[model samples]
Target: MQFIDLKAQYDQIERDVNERIHAVLQHGQYINGPEVRELENRLAEFVGTAHCIGAASGTGALLMAMMALGISAGDEVITSPFSFVATAETIALLGAVPVFVDIEPDTCNIDPGLIEAAITDKTKAIMAVSLFGQCADFDAINAVARRHGLPVIEDAAQSFGATYKGNPSCGLSTIGCTSFFPSKPLGCYGDGGACFTSDEILATRMREIREHGQDRRYHHPRLGINGRLDSIQAAVLLAKLPLFPHEIEKRRTIGRQYTEALAHDRIIPPVVRPHNTSVYAQLTIRVDDRDALQEALKQQDIPTAVYYPVSLHHQPVFLRPDAHLPVSDEVAAHVLSLPMHPYLSDEQIRRVTTAVLEAV
Candidate 1:
C-alpha cells in the first residue's frame, strides 16, 4: 500500500545488510575506506564503464562532472525542463545558463529533434535526464552532439538499472551520473552517487575533482569539492547490488500489469519504447483531472504520488522569462505516480488497479 516499499525490500535482505554494516563498523574507515573502492569497482563493471568515481550525492556527481568539463560562468548547457531540479540546479550553480528543451509527451524525455536549434557557441554540454526510469533517445541525442562536437551527460539517477538499445543507461553518454538515494532503483542506505565515463582523461579529472582537486595526498591541482562517498553507504550498496537485476525484472512485470489493467481506463499508462527497458522508478500515469484521481484512489486506501508538479524552467529560483515548453508544462500538470515497487504482490497490484479503474 506504500509508494516504493523499501521497508519490505529491506526485510528480504536484513541479514546481509546487517552483516555489511557490521563489517564497515569493525573496519572503522568511514572516510575513503576499502569498501568504498570495492563498491566503485563493482559499479563500474556493472555499468560497463572504464571508471566509476564515487560521490557524496547525485547532485554532487553532476556538479563534479560539469566542473571537470570546464563549464563556467557565461556558458550554456542544453537540457530538458521536465526533470528533477538537480538537473538544472547544477548548471546554475556554476553560474552557467540551462537552455531549456521540450520533452516528448509520451515518454516525458527530452526531444532530440529540437536540440540542434538550442545549440550555440556557448553551449558546453547536453544533459539528458532519464525521467521515471526510462532513458531518453541517446542515439539521436548523441548524433546531434557529435555533429556539434559536444559532450553529453546522462542523468541516469532514475534509470540506473535500465537499458537503452541494449546498452546500459549509465554507460550510453560521454559522462553518466547516477544517485544512490534510498528511493532510487539502485540505492544505498544513505545519500551516495557515482559518475561513469569511458574517457580515461575525463575520468582522471573527475576523480581528482571529487577530492578537492587533489592530484595526490594534500596536493591541490584545481578548484574542486569534497564529494567522496562514505564507507558505510558503500557497504550498504554492496549488499543491495546483488539483488538489483531480479528486482528490475519484477518492476517491469508490475509495470506491464498496470499498463494492461489500465488500458481502457481514464488514465494513460507509461509508454516504454521497443528497444528500451525501464526500471519503473515510479509507475506514473496521466489523467485530465490528476488531483481528483489521486483523491479517489486515496479514498480506497491506495497511495499515489506526483513525480513533479512543476517543470524546472518554471521553478521560481531558475525561471526563464522567455520560456515556452507546452508539452513539458502540460505533462507537469497531468502526471501522477501510483504505488510501484518490486515487492508489490499480485493482490496489491490488483487492489491498486481496481481503485484506479473505479476512480477514473
Candidate 2:
C-alpha cells in the first residue's frame, strides 16, 4: 500500500547499507570524502560517461551544469513546461530565461518537434526533461541541437536508470543531470545529485563549480556555490548501486502489469516508446475526472498523486499569458501518478488498478 516502499528496499540492502555508512562514519571525511569519488566513478562507468560530479541536489547539478556551460543572463534555455519546476528554475536562477514549450501528450516529455521553432538568437541551450522515468526523443532532439549548434542538457532526474536507443539517459547529451532524491529510481538516504559528461573541460569546470569554483583549496577561480554531495549519502548510493539493475527490472514489470490492467475506455495508461526502457519512476495515467478518480481511489485506501496539476506556463512564478502550449495544458489537468516502486507486489498492483478502473 506504500506509494514508494523504501522500507522494503532498505530491508533488502540493510547489511550493505549499514556497512557502508559505518565505514563513512569511521573515515570522518564527511565532505568530498573518498566515498564520494568512488560513487562518482561508479556512476560515470554505469552511464558510459567519462566523468560524474557529485552535487548537493538535482537542482544544484542543473545549476552547476548550466554554469559550466557559461549560460548567463538573458540567455534563453528552451525546455518543457510540463516538468518539475527545478527543470526551469535552475535556468531562471542563473538570470537566464526559460522558454516554455509543449510536451508530447503520451510521454509527457518535451516535444522535440516544437524545439526548433522556439530557438532564436537568445537560445543558449536545450534542456530536455526525461519525465516519468522515460527519456525524451534524444536522437531527434540532438539533431536539432546540432543544427542550432547548442548544447543539450538532459534533465534525467526521473530517468537516471532508463535507456534511450541503447544509450543511458545521462550519457545522451552534452551535460546530463539526475537527482538522488529518496523517491527517485536510484536514490540516496538524503539529498544528492550528479552531473555527467564526456567533455573533460566541462567535467573539470563542474567539479570546481561544485566546490565553490575552487581549482585549489582556499583559492577561488570563478563564481560558484557549495554544491558538494556528502559522504554519508554517497555511501548509501554505493550500497544500493549493485542492486539497481534488479530493481529496474522489477519496476519495468510492475509498470507493464499496471498498463495491462488499466486498459479501459476511460483510462489512458502510460506509453513507453519502442526504443526506450523506463524505470517507472511514476506509473502515471490520464483520466477525465482526475480529482474525482483520485478521491474514489483514496476512499479505497489507494494512494494516488498528481505529478503536476498545473503547467509551468500557468504557474504564478513563471506565468506566460501568451503561452500556447495546448498539449502541456491539457495533460496537466488529467495526469495522475499511482503507487510505483520496485517492491510493489502483484496483489498491490491489482488493488491499485482495480480501484482505478472502478473509480474511472
**Highest-lDDT candidate:** 2
Error of 1 at 343 (Å): 0.3
Q: Which stretches of candidate 2 lie over 4 Å from their true place?
A: none
Indicate the residue-level lDDT of 258 in model 1.
92
Models, CA RMSD each: 0.8, 0.6
lDDT of 1 by residue, 58-153 (tens): 999999999999999999999999989999999999999999999998999999999999999999999999999999999999999999999999
Candidate 2: C-alpha lDDT: 0.95
lDDT scores of the candidates, listed in order: 0.93, 0.95
lDDT of 2 by residue, 223-281 (tens): 89999999999999999999999999999999999999999999999999999999999
Q: Top model by TM-score, which number?
A: 2
Tell me how many residue pairs clash in candidate 1: 0
